[model samples]
Target chain A: MTDELRSRMVELLPRLRRFAVALTGDLDQGDDLVQETCMRALSRVDQWQPGTRLDSWMYRIAQNLWLDRMRAKKVRGVQVDVEAAEALAGPNGRRVVESRLTLDAVGAAMAYLPEDQRVLISLVCIDGLSYKEAAEVTQTPIGTVMSRLARARRELHARLEGHTREAIPRQQAPKPGRNT
Target chain B: MSDTPDEKTPAQPIGDDLIMPYADGVLAPDQRPAVREALARDPELMQRFEGFLFTRGPLARAFDAVLAAPIPERLLEAVRGPTPQRTRPTVSLLGSVRLARLAEMFRVPDFSPAVAVPAVLVGLAAGWLAHYAIGIAVPVDSRGVVDTASLQRALEVTPTGGSAKIARGLSLAPRFTFATDQQVWCRQYALIYGDGLEAGGMACRAPDGVWQVLMSTPPVPGVRAQGPRPAGEGPGGNTPPNNENVLDGVRSLFKQGDVLGREKEADVIKDRWKTP
Candidate 1:
C-alpha cells in the first residue's frame, strides 16, 4: 500500500469500526467487517481514487461485507459468542453487547427497519454522511433517502419505545429480533 | 445532546411536526426562527425536539467503545502486510480530540426510559419509594409521588446546573457522588428552588445503569442544614444534620469522603454508562 493510503486507513479505523458496529450490531462482527474492508481496500488498491472520500468508500465496503456475512449466516445457524463478546467489551462491552440489556437495543431497533432504511441511517444518521453522499453510497435518489430516513427514524423511535413488536422468527435471521 | 433548537434566533410557536426537520438540520433557515421560538416556551415540545436529537445519536453511543478499542491484530497485520515492510508509524487510530468527542456522545436515554436503562428495572418508576409525601420540584403522577424517571434523567445525563427546563420545570443540582455497597455509583443532589420545594436525595446507578433514588428528605428543619460544601468547605459539613426526625425514617448511608466533585461524578457516570 502507498504511504498516503496507509495513513488514511489508520485515520479511518475509528470511523470504519463505528460503521461496522452499526451495520453488524456488535463489535465481534464489527471487527470482522473492518478487517475484511481493510483487506479488500488494500488488495484492490486501484479501485479507489486518491482524493475521494475514502471513509465513504470504506463504509460501503464494510456494508457490503456485512451483507455478505448475513447471507452466509443463512446457510448455518447464527452464532454470536457470548463470552467472546463480553471479553471484547473489556470491563464494559458496549461494543459487544451494545445494549445495557442482554442485546443491543439500537441494533434491535434498526432491525425493525428495512435494509434500505438501515443503510440510510448507518450512512447519514450515525456516520455523518451528507444526503448526497448517502444517496451516492446507497445508489438511491436523494428524496428517497430523505423520506426513507424519516420513516426509519420514526420506526426506530417506536421500536425503541416498545411501541412496535418484532415479528417472531421461525429460524435465525440477521435482522435484530428477540435472540432467545 | 443539544436540546436547544437553532441558535440563530429565539424560539417561536410552531407545529410539533416541524420538530424533526429542525432537529435533522434540514429545516429551512428562514423557518428556524419560529420553530426555535416555539421550542423555548414549550417544555413538552422542547422534550419532543430533544427526542429527535437522541434518535440520531443512539447508534454512535451504542458502538462508541469500538472507537477506543485496539484494532484486531488480523486487521492491523492485513494493513502492515500489504505495505512494503517498513516500521509502521505509531499513529493513534483516533486522536485524543476525536476520542473525547466519541466519549461525549453517551447520553442518558431520552423518550424511552425502558429502552435506555433496560437492566434491573422496569422503567424504574420506584412506586414503592413513594412513602415520602413531601413537596417536589418535578410534577408527580396521580399518587402524589415523584417518579424516579425525570429525576434520574437529570442525575444521569445533565451536568450540574446544566439541565434544560425538563419535567415540571424543576432545577436540579447534583450535590455529590458515592459508590454503593454493590459498587454501584450513586449521586446526591438538591431539588434546589423549584415549585417551592427544597429537598435532597441520593440516586445510585443500579447495575442496570438506572439511578435508583435511595433516600429523599427535605433537609433538616431546625438544625440548620449545611449548603453544598465543595472542596473548600473542609469537610465541616461531613456530618449531615444530627437530627433524627430529618432522616424521615430513611436510613442514612454513605460515609464521609464518599461525595466527589461534580466533574469527578460525571467521570464516574461516564464510566458506569460505558459501552457494553
Candidate 2:
C-alpha cells in the first residue's frame, strides 16, 4: 500500500489512544492497550486486507484486546455512573486544567463499566462505529449486539439517575441534626 | 409508576445500537427528531445519553496523550545503530542529536581564541583545496566554448568532439583548429585533462595573450613505430607534435607576419586599452 496507511497511523494514534483509554479506564493501561494494538498491527500486517476501513480494523483489535485482558483477569469491576462523570467532566477540557479534570472523571467512569459494555460504548458512541461494524468486530450477531446495547443503556441510565437523586434534596428525608 | 418497582418502560427501551449512534450524531437526520423526542420526555434517559457522549470525548483525549507521550531514549538509540569507533557517526536518531554533537565538538581541551581562530582558518584552506582538486579532476560544466584560447582560459580543460573553433585576439579571429576528443564540452572552471589514443594537454594563457602548456605528454610513443611514424612528425607539416608546438608555431608566424596576430593584437589594444 501507499505510505497512506503508515501516515494515517500518526493521525489515528490519538484517536486509537482515546479508544484505549475508554476501554482500559486507566492512563497507563490505555497506553499498554495502544502498544499492544500497534504491535499486533505490525505483526499481523498481512491480515489487514487493503481498501477496508483501517480505523474499524484498529478499533476491533483494541476491543478484542480489552476483552482478552478481562477474560484473563476474571475480576469484575464496578461500573461508574456516566452521567455523574459527565456532570463533572462538562463535555471536554476546553480549558487546560479543566480538561484534565474532566478527562480523569471520564476515565474513572469508563473504568466503572463492565468490559463488554465499555467496549461497545466506545466503539459505537465514542468512535462512532455503526452496529454492523461493531458486530463485525465483536464477532456477535447484530441482534445480540442490540440486546447488549439495550442492557448497557438501561444500566447507565439507572446509575446516572441514582447519582442525580442522591445529589438533590429528598422529600422523605429530614435533617439529621434536627428532630421532627 | 407505583406498580413498576421492577418493570422497565414498555417502549422496548432505546438500545445502545440506537442510543449510541444517536449520541455520536451519526443517526440519519430524519431519524434524529424521533430520538430527540424520546430524550425530551425522559430526563434520566437524556442524562445517560449525554454521559455516554461526554465520557467518550475524554476517552478520546487520553488516547492522544498516550500517543504524544515522549518515546524513551533507549528506543531511539535502538532504532539508530551505535556509532562505530573511527567511522563518521550517522546520527539518525532525532533531528536534535546533531545540534547536541555540534555543541560537544565546540568544547576542546585547552581551548583558546587563538587556537580556535587558526584551526578555523586551516580548516577553510583545506576545504578549499579539496574542493579545487575534485573540481579539476571531474569538472562538470557542459557549456564550455571549444576554442584553444578559451581552453587556455579555463581553470579546467576537456576535449570537445566537433571542430574546435577558437577565437583569437580582439576581433575574435579564428586561428588553429582540431576535431574534438569527446562529444562533450563544459563551461565550468575546473582543470579537465585526458590523454589516451589522443595525447591531451592543459594549456594556460599567459598575461601577454600567448597560450602556454602547463602539462603535456610526449608525441613519440615509447616504442618506435616502423612505418610513416605519425602525422605531425617528419616532413609534411600538417599537425604539430603537440598543443605546445601549435602555440609556438602560431606565435612565430605572428612575429613573421605570415599569419594574422599583430593586426588582431592592435585592434584589441585599441578597443580595450583605455588609460583612465
Candidate 3:
C-alpha cells in the first residue's frame, strides 16, 4: 500500500468505526466493515486521488462493501427479516435500562427502514452530516435524498411507536394490496 | 414499550431538512417560528419529533462510551502492524500537524461518572482545601447561638492567647467556627485569610444551630493564582492545604486515635470548651 493510503486508513479508522457501528448496529460488524473498507481501499490504490476527501472515498468503499454483502446474501436465497435482524443488534438504550429501551427502539426503527433510507439515515441522522453532503455520499440527487430521508423518518416513527405489525408474508396480504 | 401507541399515525409534513436541523438546534434563528408553528399543529408528530430531540441529549451522554470502548491492544497492534516496513516519510509535515491538532481538539475523555466527576472535583477541592490550610478559621454564631464551647471542642481546641487553635491543617473544615458569634468569626477569618483561598467566604448557622461554612472552603482554589501547587508555585502554594494528606489524617484519627465511638463525649466537650 502507498504511504498516502496507509496514512488515510489511520485517519479514517475512528469515523469508519462509527459509520460501521451505525450501519451494522454491532461493534464487531462495524469493525469488519472498517477492515474490509481498508483492505479494498488499499487493494484499489489507483482510484483514490490525493486531493479529494479520504473520509468520503473510504465511506464509498464501505457502503459498496456493505451493499455487496446484502446482495450476496439475497442471491444466496437468505431474506433479511429486518425485525429479526433488529432484535440481534446492540449499543442499545440510554442512561438506565429505560434509556437503553429508548435507544434500542430507535435502533430497531432505524434498522427496519428500506435500504436507501437506512443508508441516508445512518449518514444524516447518526453521523450528523448535512443533507447536501449526504446526497453526495449516497450518489443520489438532492431531492431524492430529501424524499428518502423524509420517508425514513416516517418509517422510524412508525416502528418506534410499535406500529410495525409483524412482517406479514407477502402472499398473506390482500392480493390486490400489491399495487406498488 | 407497550405504552407506545398501537397504530402509527400518518406523518405530518415535517421534512427531513426541517426535523434534522431542528433536532440538532442548528436551524437559523428566523426559521424557528415556522417549525414551531408546524410542530404545534400535530401532537403525535410532536411526540415523535421530541423523541429525536430528547435522544440527542442522551446520545451525547452515550457518545462518551464510544471513546471508552477499549480497543483490544492486540487489535490495535494488528491494525498498526509492521509500521517499520511501510515507512512513508514524504508527507508534508504541516498537514500532519494540522490534522493532529484537529484530532486532539475532538479527542474524548474516558467515560464514567467516577472519572469525570473526580477530575473536576479534585481540582475544585484542591483549590478549597489549599485555602483552608493556612487560612485562619473564624468562629461565628451567625444565628446568635453563642455555643462557643462546642465549636472549640469540635476542633480539639488548644488555648492560643485570646483565640484558640482549632485543629491546624483543616482543609475540608467549613470556614465558620462553631460558636454563638459565628458570623463575626467567619467574617474575621475571611478578612484575614480569605486571600489565596476560597473567595467570598461567609458564615452561616446550620439547622441544628451549629455554625458552618456557608460556602465551605470550596474543594478547589480560586481561579486567580491557580498555577503549580505541587511544588508550591502560587501565592497559596507556600501553604497549600493538603486535603489528601489531611483526609488521610482524619481517617487515621478515627482508626488509630481516639475520635470514634465517643460521639456524646465529643459533643459534650464541644459544647463546654469556650475560647478565652
Candidate 4:
C-alpha cells in the first residue's frame, strides 16, 4: 500500500511542480518548495488514508509551507531574469521576448497581490481547481473564495492591460477598461 | 424616464460578483442569462468580461515550462528514502547521524535508538548553529501535538481562518472547528516548522479544557525500500485522483452538525468550549 502511494506521488510530481512554480514564481525556489513538500508528505504517508485525493493533500501541504515561508519573510522577492529569458530567444527572438514579457508582466502583477489572493489565483486560475476546491484547500468559505478570486482577476486584468498600454502607445492600445 | 436623453442613458453595469463567474464559465445556468444580457447590451461590460477571460490563458500557460523540465533527482531521493547502504552503520556512529541530519533530516525511520539519539543531538547542535548563523531561532522539536503553551493559546483564542505564532520558528493555523458525534469540540490545524516541515492534525478539546491531540500526522515508516522509477514509466504525472476529498477522512469523526461559523466560533472560544 505504501509503495503504491509512493508511485502515485511520483506521478504527481509534474503537476505539483507546476503548482509550486506558479505559486513561487521562480523555478529553483519552487522546486525546492516541492522537494520539501514531498519529503513532508512521504514522512506522513500513513496519515494519508487511501481513497483521498493525493494531489489536493500535497497541494495543501505546499500551500501551508509557502504561507509559512511568506510569514517568516523568508521568500525572496519575485525576480524575473530578463537576461536569462532573452537568452532563450534564439531564432524567434521578438516573438519569444514578447511572450516572455507578457508572462513576466503577469507574474509581476501577481506578485503585487496579497499572498492570499495570489494563492487563489494560482489554485483556481492557473491550476484549474474549482472555486469550491480552492476554498477547501485554503480552508476558506466558498463565498470568500469566489469574491477573492473575482477581485484577483479584476486586478490582474487591470495590471496586465496597463502594462500593455505602457508597452504600446496609449492611442494604439485597446480600451478595455474604458466606460461606454 | 423621458427626461433622460437617449445618448446619456447609463449602461447597466455588471458586478464582478456576477460577471467574473460568468466570464470563467462557472456561473450557475439560471444566473447566466442576466450577465449575458448585460454583456450583450453594454459594450463596456463585454469588454470588461473579455479582459477577465484574456488573462486566463496566459496565466494558465505561464508555468508550463516547469512541467516539461525533468524532475530533480534530489526530490526523487526524498520520496524514495535513504538507500539501503546508507542505513548500514559502516560509518562512525556520529557520522551516520550527521548524514541523517543532512541528507535525510526526517527520513531515517529505520534507525535504531542508538542512531536516533545521536541524530537528535546533531539536530539540536545544527539548530543552534543555524540559529547563530541565520540569526533566527531554529526549533529543534518538530512535533505537531498541541501541548505547548503557545499552541494552547492559539487553539483557544485563534478563530478559524486565523493563525498564530507558536514559537520563534513554528506557526499554527487552525482550519476549522466541529463537534464530534460524542459532542466533543475538535479543531483541525496545520503547523509550519521553521525548518520547512509542515504537520497537520486534529485536536479535540477534552473535558478538562485541554486540547488533546486526537491525531497528529508525523512521519511514519514506509518507502525505505522503494527506489526511483524511470521518469516516463508512469502515466502522465499530476492527474488528480477521483477518490474522496482529503477532508473526508475526518468527516466520520464528527456529526452532521454545521461547521461553526466565525461569530459562533468566537463565542465558543470566549466561553472556553463550555456547554451553554
Candidate 5:
C-alpha cells in the first residue's frame, strides 16, 4: 500500500472501531472485528478505486464480516442469551441495572436489537452517516433504510425508557365489533 | 367542512415515520413547517419526537470511549506493513522515528506486581506460597523463551482475540498473528493475572513446535481500561496502554503482508504451525 493510503486507513480506525463495537456489542470482539476488516481491506487494496470513499468501503467490509460471524455462530448453536446473562449477574445485578440509566444505556440496549437493526442504528445514529449514505453502504433502498431506522430508534427508546410503555395517544383504537 | 377538500390534512397523526425523520433533521424544508406545527400543538407527538432525539447523543458518545482507547500495536503493525530493514541502504529514518514514538507512547512504570514485595511480610509470604502452590507463572528462560506448558497449549489452541484460562488466576488472550520476513508466524497475547495486572508479549512457534517468547512487558496495573473517559488520555492517565514497546522492539520481525485471518490462523494452529 502507498503511504498515503496507509495513513488514511489509520485515520479511519477510530470510526471503524466505533462501528465494530456497536455491531459486536463487546469491546474485544469489536477490536478483533476491526483487525479482521483491516486485514481484508489491505489484502484487497487493489480492488478499491482511488477516488472512492475508503471509509464506506471499510464499513461495508466490517458489516459483512460481522454478519458472517453471526451466521457461523448460529450454525454452531452457540448463540448467547444476552438478557439471560444480564439477569444472572448476581452481586453485580444492581450495578448492571444502574448502568442501564447512564450514557452507556443506549449501547447496552442496542444489544437487544436484531443484527439488521443494530447495523442501521450504528450507521445512522452513532457514525453520523446520512440515511441515503447508509442505504448506499448497505445496498438497501432509502425508504427501507428510513423505516428500519425509525423502528430501530423507537425500539431503542422503548428499551431505554424501561418497561412501562409511555402513554402516547393512539390515532385510533379498533372498534369492539370491527372484525366481527 | 368545505365541499372541496384541501391537500393539507391537519388531522393526520404524525407517526414515527414522520417524527423520526423530523428529529433526525432529514425531513425536507417544506415538510418541516407542518411537523413543527404538529409538534407544537400535540404533546404526544412532541414526546415521540424527543424520544427519537434522545438516543442519538448518548449512542454516539457511548462508543467514543472505544475510539479514545489506544489502538492495539498489532493493528498498527498490520497497517504500517513490515518494518523496513535498517541495514538496507534505501531504508528511511522515518520508520525508526515512528517506532520510537510508539515506544514512548506506551512507556509504563517499571514495576512487576508479581515479584514486588509489600510492606506486610505476612501477606508477601502467603502470596508467594499461593504462587508456588498454583505453579502457574510465566518463567522466561535465559534465551527469553516462556517455558510453561499451560501457556504453550493456550497459545496453540486459542484463536486470535480469544482468551483461555491457563491456570488459577491467570488467563492468556492472543491478540493477533503476523509472519516475519523469514516467514515465521508470531502471535501476540496478553497474560492477565487475577489482580488486574496484565502482561503482554509475543511468542513465535519455532520449527521445533516450541513457542519461543520474543518479548514480554512487566505486568501493568489495569485489566483493559473500559468505559467512557475523556479523549486523549495517554500514559499518565488511568487508561492502560497495551504492550506497544514489545512491538517496537520486534519491528524488524514483521513481513510486508496481511495479518492472518480467522480461518487461516485456525488452519495454521490445526497444522501445528508447520510450514504450509
Candidate 6:
C-alpha cells in the first residue's frame, strides 16, 4: 500500500522480466507472467514483511506463478505457448566480449533441460544468485541447488556443443577447440 | 576429471563440484586463489572454466539488455496504477483491509464522554461522544489528557489507524502536520474507533521530542450543522470542518501554519522542518 514498497517493485521489473523470460522460454508469455506476478504482489503487499529482500520475494513469486502455469498447461494438454516467443531485442555488440554468447543457441540448448533445471540455471548462471540465495528463491536445500546447477551447466554445455554429456569428463578432457 | 591422459597437474586435481563455482566466482574466498592458481596451471581446467563461463556469460548479458528495456506500462500500472505519464501516479488497486486501514489512520474515534466531557456537562447534556456510541472512561486530569502513554506511542510509531500497532490493540494515525508560529512541531492523531466516530487530538513535540498535549476533539463530527448542541452553548470554534457534529465555539489554542504532507511530516518528526 505504501509507495516505498511499490516503487521498489517497479525498479525490479526488468530483472524480474529477465527471470520470467528464462523460466517461460518465451518473451511474450514471460512478460504476461511478470505482469501477473506484479499484480499479485501489489494486491498482497502486506504479506511481505518490511526490511526483507524485495528481489528475492519477487523471484519467489515469479517462480511459483510460472510453475503453476506449467502445471495448468499440462492439465489442459497444451504445449509451448510459442505465439509470444518473439525475441524482444537481439544481442547488442556493445556488451563485453565474455557475455556475447547468442540467446538463440543458448535458448535452444536450454530448452532441453527440465523446468526445475532451467530455473536453477537461470538463477545461478544467468541471474547471478549465489547457491544459498538461489536455494532461498527456489525453496531448496543448498546441497540440492549446488548439485543441480552443476549438472545443469554440464548438460547445457554439452547440448550447445553437439556432444553427448557422457563424452565430457569431470577432469582433464580434450579441450574443445572453439576460438571464443 | 577429463580423460585426455596426456597432461597431469602437479596440484590436487579439482573435482566436478569445485569447477563450476570457481568459474562462477562463487567459491569461498580462501579457496578462490588456490583454484585460480590451479586454473592457470591446467589448460583443461581453464577450458572447463571457460566453458562454464560461456554458459553463463552471454545468457546473463542478453538478459541484462532486457533489464534495460522498458518495463511494460501494464506492469508499472499494477504496482501503482493511474499514474500520470510524468509526475504523481494515480491511486492503485488498494485491498479492502488497506482501504479500511487508510480510513482508520486518517480519523480516530473517541467516545469517552465521561472523561472528555465535564462530569456536570455529561449530566446536563448528552454530547456527541456519548451519542457516537463509545463510552470508555479515560482518566483526564485538569489538563484534558486521556491515555497519555497510548497517546504518546501513537504519536511516535503507529501514525495511522490501520498501520499503527500500539498497546492494547488500539490504533492511531496522523491526519495533519503543522508547525505552530512558536516553531513547535505538532500533529493531529486519532483513536481508531470508539462508539462510531473517530476522536482526534493535536499534540506539539516538546524540545525533548515529547509530544505535549494541545487539544483533543470529543468524538464529534467536524461539520457544523450536525453539532449536537447549539453554536453558543457547545464546545465551539475548533471542530474539524468535515465533521458536521463539532460545534463552532470549540477552538484549538495552538496557532499553526499550513498542514504538511506525509513526507514533510516525516521530516518534521526527524527534526528536519523545511518551509513548503
Q: Model-by-model lDDT, in order?
A: 0.53, 0.43, 0.44, 0.58, 0.61, 0.54
All DockQ scores: 0.17, 0.09, 0.07, 0.23, 0.25, 0.25
Candidate 4 displacement at residue B240 in angstroms: 36
Tens-place lDDT per residue, model 6, A100-136, is 5555546645655667778888888888888899999
- Judging by TM-score, tell me the better candidate of 1 and 6: 6
Q: lDDT by residue for model 1 over A1-180, one digit each (tens)?
A: 374465457546766877877776667777787888899988888999876888878777777777677667745764442332233232432223333422366765565455567777788777778778998887678767766776667666544544344333213323532211
Ranking by lDDT: 5, 4, 6, 1, 3, 2
Instruction: Tell me the tens digit of each residue's lDDT in model 3 across B1-276.
Output: 222222223332454566656766766776666667778986765765665664445433333333223333222223445423212221111124432432342233432222222222212132332342211122322222222222322333311111232212221222212222221122112111223443123332222222233222223454433432221111243443432222222222222222222343235335432221
Clashes of each: 10, 14, 25, 1, 0, 34
Q: Write the per-residue lDDT of candidate 4 for residues A64-159, one digit (tens) a residue.
A: 998788765533543333433233233543223244334555555565556778788888888888888898888889878877787777766665
After superposing all C-alphas onto the true structure, candidate 2 shows an RMSD in angstroms of: 27.6
State each candidate's chain A TM-score.
0.73, 0.70, 0.75, 0.75, 0.80, 0.77
Candidate 3 local lDDT, A6-91, one digit each (tens): 53355346556667766665567767777777777777879988778777787888888887876776678655545534452344
Regions more than 4 Å wrong, model 3: A1-5, A81-97, A101-107, A161-180, B1-17, B26-30, B54-67, B72-79, B83-276
Model 3, global lDDT: 0.44
Better of 4 and 5 by DockQ: 5
Candidate 6 matches the true fold with a TM-score of 0.49
Model 5: per-residue lDDT, tens digit, B40-154?
A: 9898788778778866765576665565554665565566554331112111212345434434433423532322222111221223323322211326321223325456567
In terms of DockQ, which candidate is stronger, 1 or 3?
1
Q: What's the distance in Å from true for residue B124, model 3?
A: 34
Model 1 DockQ class: incorrect
Best by DockQ: 5
| Top lDDT model | 5
TM-score of candidate 4 relative to the true fold? 0.48
Cα TM-score per model: 0.45, 0.41, 0.48, 0.48, 0.52, 0.49
Q: Give Cα distance to truth, residue A54, candidate 4, Å.
A: 1.1
